[model samples]
Target: MNASAPQQSNSTPLCYSINSPPFTYNHPIASAYYSSIFTLLGLPSNLIAFIVLIKSFKEARSRSRSFFLIFLGGLVVTDFMGLLVTGCITVSFHITHFNWRNLDPHCHFCNFMGMSMVFYGLCPLMLGAAMAVERFTGINCPFTRTSSQTKGRPISMVLLVWFTAGCVALLPLMGVGGYHIQKPGSWCFFLISYKGNDQIFSLIFSVVGLTSIAVSFLLNTVSVVTLIRVCCGQDRTQRRRDHEVEMMVQLILIMVIASICWCPLLIFIAQTVLSEADLQVRYLLLWLRFATWNQILDPWVYILFRRSVLRRISPRSDWSRSSIMTLYPTLRETIRRLTSSSLELGEMDEMGKSNVTAPPTLKP
Candidate 1:
């Protein structure tokens, strides 16, 4: 009876331990499910968006709009590559369950993946913020705009964002930060538990992500309001609407979906660093899952929020600007006002014809 007691305890060690089941991608069936979901959700949407972007680019009339389409093209490319690159590595890891220390003795693989995760994650948020700024300038600051809206500027800015993300992603390799195999160990990212450099790195990632979201929200709100005013104004001279309103609708949806899916992870990163709290493995996994949703849903913002889609769904749309129904209901009222104005114009012309005063002048 005394010898019956087992030498090993039933309780499992912490998830931080290398090669531990809790820390590694040990479940094959679950990994397969994850791989399928990401592939199906992210791949087609991005490809379709790419095709649509090319056609739209050719159709773009204004210089600013052409630049904006270029930005959208860059975003589509980022999302497509982000999905392809990260998905391949993740699926391979889960399928193989390779030992990180054995497979990557020099930590090169770990570091590269860590950097890729950060680079891809930051790019979309940064791009969203950049698009918002471009739209705001096109709407509110068109006359005062500088040379930044030049043909090369949009492409240059895209490259700059990619370069900046790459630099930050490499900071861990430069000793400013570090990356570790995070839970289910297939992926590498910043872990908040480490004290000096890792903590700083986590804070930096969080700050940059949060700031991009903030800037996007502010600028997008202002731009949307400006567009709403133009579409709703009583001034008859303001009949010509900004064709960029449809693009603005897409931008707003992208920002909103991104904020919804990413804010939790970004906030979690900040809280874990600040509090030095016990790592909540479940919470981290949950938030990480949330972040992936942004990639899956982002391309659809462009695909679905178009003027063509709006016209197909609505009862009728004589006004192009009426397609902004994805963001606000106030635009429905504007559509009614425009339709009413057309009827009123017809009635006013008839009244003018009836009030002809030819007989009065002859009698005098």
Candidate 2:
């Protein structure tokens, strides 16, 4: 071998090393604090979402109700997963105590958690897209319902969402695209890097993310248009139309929020791929972290605004029972007497009819 060749090979490897110094002490401190805040926000919101959805599942069997519940459940699951993975990474980095090279176990855990977080994060959006499509089909095509009206479509949509999310997440494990543990740390992410086939991975992620956003936008738009046309110049009852409009509005809003939260991250990824400016890349990454926080916000929006979800939690009897009992201590007795009187009237009518038909039995 030529004497100079070894020197050139050594320099090539040096260029690949990520020498970006640690983020400033203040910056890391701020990020760690923010991560804690996000964790706290996500945990409670997900708990509420889980409870609301479980209650909804117990009460109703309609397609709309079932789909909404499934959507909320997926949201809670993803948010919790994100919180777990992201919070762990933040905590590890905050104290400056991690030794990536020595701790093989933490490295493996980081990789698994990172992949899971990405997988779950994408799962809810895919489910939301499926939901919009189901709603559109149900409203626009009445015959489709006549053929199969037992909530099959919504369930199928939910299954498809989960399957698609699993496939997307497994892409990394299959070696099509893989996550990397950050240098001198156990923190793993899908962020752009010079190592491995990062460019290809980044491209693939951007394409998938943007395509999902576009589909959501299209589906939501069509649903809104159909809802408007159905509600306007119609002879249907005002209350029924209003309810339908409200549901459509809620679905559209959900899609819009998902798109708004995820779109920036996709655009930033694409920009990072095309730009060579380090400052621009850093700024974009900062914003992308903010957008990821949107996952936490999505479930809370559903909990706070969706009337169907809220109504399932608070039944009409629940509202009236306490007040009625407080106002009249004998309310239970009154109800019992009314029920007994109705039963007695029915029994008397039955006996009189029997007597009329018992001509020969009168001798006995």
Q: Which tens-of-lDDT digit does each residue in 160-237 have in candidate 2?
A: 777877776666555554554543342555546433555666677677767766776787788777766554422333
lDDT string for model 1 (30-112, tens) is 35567658867898989999999899889887787788888989999998888888788888876787776667654567767
TM-scores for all candidates: the values are: 0.80, 0.70
What's the true lDDT of residue 176 in model 2? 50
* Overall local distance difference test of candidate 1: 0.78
- lDDT at residue 297 of model 1 (Cα atoms): 92
Model 2 clash tally, residue pairs: 0
Q: Evaluated with TM-score, which candidate comes out highest?
A: 1
10 residues in a row with least lDDT, candidate 2: 12-21
* lDDT assessment of candidate 2: 0.60
State the TM-score for model 2: 0.70
Number of colliding residue pairs in each model: 0, 0
Looking at model 2, the pairs that clash are none
